[model samples]
Target: MRDYFIRRLLLIIPTLLGATIAVFFITRIVPGGPLEARMRQAMAMASERSMKDAGGSLSEEQKEQLAAYYGFDKPFFPAYLIWLGAAPQEVEKQFIKFEEGQNEAKVTLKTLLPRAQWTATNAFKVSEATVDRKGALTGPDVVGWKTKAEPEKQRVTVFRTKFNGLLQGNLGVSTRYNDRVWAMIKERMPVSIFYGLITFILTYAVCIPLGVIKAIKHRTVLDNATSVVIFIGYAVPGFVLGSLLVVYLAARMGWFPTGGFVSDNFSQLSVSGKVWDLTHHAILPLICYMVGGFAFMTMLVKNNLMDNLAADYVRTAIAKGATFRGAVLGHALRNSLIPLATTLGQIVTVFVGGSILIERIFDIDGFGMLSFQAVTDRDYPLVMGVLVVSAFLTLLGNILSDFFVALADPRIRFR
Candidate 1:
């Protein structure tokens, strides 16, 4: 198992790399760039100010500066390299000489060559030069032969991409939120986990026992009634149920809060009051999240248990002087849970992804809603951050589910 785990962990590197590459290029193919969006926002603000205070729009030089600031002036591949922190920032510096009689100063475009050589072009021939202590030249030998003025330095970014983004825990900044992507995710994660964990716990707690009962009372009226109830819950979508609950329970009866995960004045409440307020706000959203899972998981458990009960080994156990209860509980029950155990991976994935529509309907500011907003706003950094986290969890979940399956069924082994 140790070796198996090590190998699986090592395999995640290439898998994640491929996933990131796909996400990066695919997002790039989207219709608009972040710089363009920023420009539009700036123009809109300028327009608003103009209407109120007679302010002018952004100048051409200001527009270029904005493009340069965001590194949009460079080619896509070079910008991508810079983003990955793969290359150093390139700066443009110009050397100017003040001639005695010339109207304009003699300007020589000098850039630091790859080997630290100062290469000057589009200027007069070199006559004399002075190198500084650091090998940086103060005065270059020029044919124009005059006093030197202050050199102009303009910084431009190149291959500056941070390849260690995932490793170093920096997921980059969101253009839409104007904040770090990780920070935004961190803020929203707790709400999602709160709802997801509750749904998971309750779904298993209720469904497993209910399934066992239904399987035990197969073809009885109780079983038939349970089937009708769970199927009805299953058929209704969580968003639809949430809307109905809001209209009937919140609007009509005033039993629960219509939307949101907590009261606005929750912090001012007493401890018990806080808990009650939280539960009140949570009731509708929690119900919406759990109903679909409850129905599906209950039916799954029932079918798996029923199949295991009819197996020859279960019959053999009962024939060998074991009580029917012992045969079912000790032998059949264990085997029945194996199939459910395999679904643990999917559960982890769902926990991370959350329910987008349900969260949007309830106005819960969870990870799911964040993702939905990111996609709609074309926030590439946040979108990619969410995708990376989801992908990692999915891969990790598969490994965990394999271990769980191995533990549940003694016949299953990791080599």
Candidate 2:
């Protein structure tokens, strides 16, 4: 386990390095800027005018300045290396620092200036109360007070982040939303995470057993009917299913929310009532993700189980007086699941890392929503940041998938 962990950790370096390179390259292919972002929006006329105006005479200097401000100044490989190696990994540290012996350097005003006396250690205290003596940052008071400091103690943190640099729960700034990416992700994540997870659970619970049952029953009415149903689920696309569910279950039947994360008046409701409202809103999306989601997994499990059932060990178990149920659920289920269960580790990130269309359809504000907007708006840096995140997720998923292989079949070892 120790060796495996070390190997995985080592792998993350190149994984992130590659992600940085890919993200940087991909961003350059996209053009436009902050004004262009607003103007290109089909929904906003003023922004479109601004974008068109900017596009006509965006000077080389202006383009370069924009690129530099957003960290697109360097050649792709250099930028990737710099971002991976030197970018500061925290939000509160989003400040510029002067180099040692470089006398005239300064932190720019546009940067997230520390509110008076914020420190790496004392950042959390910033929201409420005065700074302790030991932690006070000495800046000129009242808009120009100048206090000299020890050159050695004068480092300011920067805000650029990468995968290997990701702190636990570090959702970076939302380049599109004009809010902390973490906050945005938090608000929408609960909706999708809760909905997707519940849906996943319901899906596997229902489908796995049903698949097993159908396989055992073998072309009886139960088996035939279940197969037909599973085929239908497999046939229908997720978005179509989601839309239909919204119309029928939520809009027509009025059993669940039609769209959106919660009712507008949820906050005004009592705590229990708010919870009830959230649950009601969640039901439709959850059902949507689940109803169409299960067939692939179910088919994978049923086939794997049936294949195992014909294995020598399975026949041997039957020969030893094991009942069909015991052979199916106890021995075969455990063995087959290692292969199938690996998928969970991969899918676990989908709620957090992807789901752009689902977020759009539901109008839920999240990383997915930001990513989608970034593409349409041509906000390159923001789009690259999201791409980097997606790459990390894919890497992490691959790592767990490998680990699952090891756990499922002990003969396989992690190097």
After superposition on all C-alphas, the RMSD of every candidate to the true structure, in Å, is 9.5, 8.9
Tens-digit per-residue lDDT, 139-236, candidate 2:
33213212223344453332323333233334334446566554554555565566656666787788778767766777799878877887797787
Candidate 2: clashing pairs of residues:
39-47, 39-48, 140-145
User: What tens-digit string does per-residue lDDT give for candidate 1 at 238-286?
Assistant: 8999989989999899888878888889889999998898888888898
Model 1 alpha-carbon miss at residue 186, Å: 1.0
Q: Using TM-score, give the best candidate's number.
A: 1
TM-score to native of every candidate shown: 0.77, 0.71
* Clashing residue pair totals per candidate (backbone < 3 A): 15, 3
